[model samples]
Target: MQYKTVELVIEGKTATLFLNRAESMNAMNIKMIDEITKALKEVAASSVNLLFITGKGRVFSSGGDLKTMLSSTDESMFHPVMDQIKNMIVTLYTMKAVTVSFINGAAAGLGLSLALACDYVKLEKSAKVAMNFINIGLVPDGGGHFFLKKRLGEHKAKQIIWEGKSIPANDALQLGIVDEIYEGDIEEQLTFMKTKMEARPIQAMIASKMIYSTQELQHLVETLNLETMNQLEMRNTEDHREGVAAFLEKRIPHFSGK
Candidate 1:
C-alpha cells in the first residue's frame, strides 16, 4: 500500500515498516500517527511471521511533531493520540509475529516508547535515545511511562523521565533497554535474527510472547477482554478484511480507511 508518512514492504514471512518522513526526522504528527496505526492494523492480520520497524534517515524518530502539538487548542484531541499509541504498543507486544526495532540514531520521547514496545531492539553504536517529555513541559505519553517503569524499575524510570537525559546506545544497552549494538551492516544482522526466528515454531513463539507480556499485567483477564473488544471493532473496518485477504492471497493490501 502507498502511504504518505510510512512505507510497508513484505518479503517472504517478514514485513518491514519504515517511517518515511526522513526530512522531519520521522516525527510523529497526526498524519504520521494515523498512517502508522493503519499500517500496524494491516500487519496484525497478515501472515507475516516477523515485523521490522526502522526509519529512513540518521534518526529513528525525533519524537512528536512540536508544530502539530502546539496547534491543537483542545487537550481532548491528545487522548486519541494516546489511545492510538497504547493500542500500537499493545499490538506489537501481543502480535503473533516477532517484532524487532532497528534504532539507527536518535529516538526521543514518544520515539523511545515506540522502540521499547518492540520485542527486540537493535541499536547503532552511535544511536541516542531519551525520554525528553519533561524538558518540553509535557508528560510522558505513548506508554513511555509504563514501559520505562516496567523495564527500568520505578526509581530509575523516574530519574530518566524527570531528568530528561539522552541515553547513548552503550548506556542503553547496559541499562537493558537495547538488546544489541551494531556498528556494521544492519541488514545482515536483521537477516540473522529473521533466520533464528523462522527456525522456531511460530505458534510457540507467539505463546511465549503472550506469556512474557502477560506476566507483568496486573489484570490479565481485563486486558484480554479489552483486546477482544478492540479486535471486534477492527474486524468491522474495510482495512481489516483487506489485510486478511491480502495475506491469504499473497498480495499487497490496499487500505482506504473506509
Candidate 2:
C-alpha cells in the first residue's frame, strides 16, 4: 500500500519501514498512525524475517503532533488516535517477524514507546531519547508504562517517566533502553543483523517471539487500553493546557498539578 507519512521497502528477508515525515521530525499524527497500522499489517502478512524500523532525516520521531493535539476539541479526537497507536504497538510486538528499531535520532514520547515495543533497538551514537509525558502533564500511553517497567524494572522506569529524563544514546545503551550504539552507516548494522539472521533459524526466532508475545504482551495490550482512558483524563487537565502552551511558546511550563 502507498503511504504518505511512511515508506515500506522489502529486500529479501528484511523489511524496512521508514517514517517519512522529516519536516515535522516524523511526528505521529492520526494520519501517520493509520498509515503505520496499514504498513504493519503488510509486514505481518509478508515473508519477511526481520522488520527494520527507522525514521527519516534528523530526528527519529518527536512523538505526537502537538499541533494536532492542542487543536483537538475533546476526548473524541484522542480515542481513535490512541486506539490506532495501541493496535500498532501490539501488532509490532506480536508480529511473526523479529523487530528492530534503528533509532537514528531523537525518540521522544510515544516514539520511545514504539521503540520499546520492538524486540531489539539500535541507536546512532548521537541519538536522544526520552519519555517526557510528565513534562506535558500526561500519562504514558501506547503501552509505554508496561514496556518500560518490563525492561527496566519498576523503580527505574517510574523514575525516568516521572522525572522526564532524556538521555544520550550511549547512556540509553548502558541502561538497556537500546541494545547497541553505532557511529557508522546503518548499512553496517543491517549487515550485522543479516549475518545473525543467517546463522539461526528464522522460524525458531519467530516462534520464540510469539511465545513471549502471548505470555507477556497480551496483558499489556489490555492494560494500555485502560491507560489510554487515564491519559485522556490527564489531557483534559489545566496542567496539560499550561504545558502545551509553554511548549509552543518556548518557555518553561508552570504546572500546578491540577
Off by over 4 Å in 2: none
Write one digit per residue (lDDT tens) for candidate 1, span 22-140.
99999999889888888888898888879999898878899988767646534467556656766666677667788889998899988888888888888989999988765544456
- What TM-scores do the predictions have? 0.80, 0.96
lDDT of 2 by residue, 1-258 (tens): 889999999988789899999999999888898898899989899888888888989888889888878777577777878888888998898899989998988999989988888898888899989999888889888888998888899899998899887899878888877888878787788778878888988899899889888898768977798888788889889999898888889999999979
Clashes of 1: 0
- Give model 1's TM-score versus the native structure: 0.80
Against the true structure, whose TM-score is highest? 2
Clashing pairs in 1: none
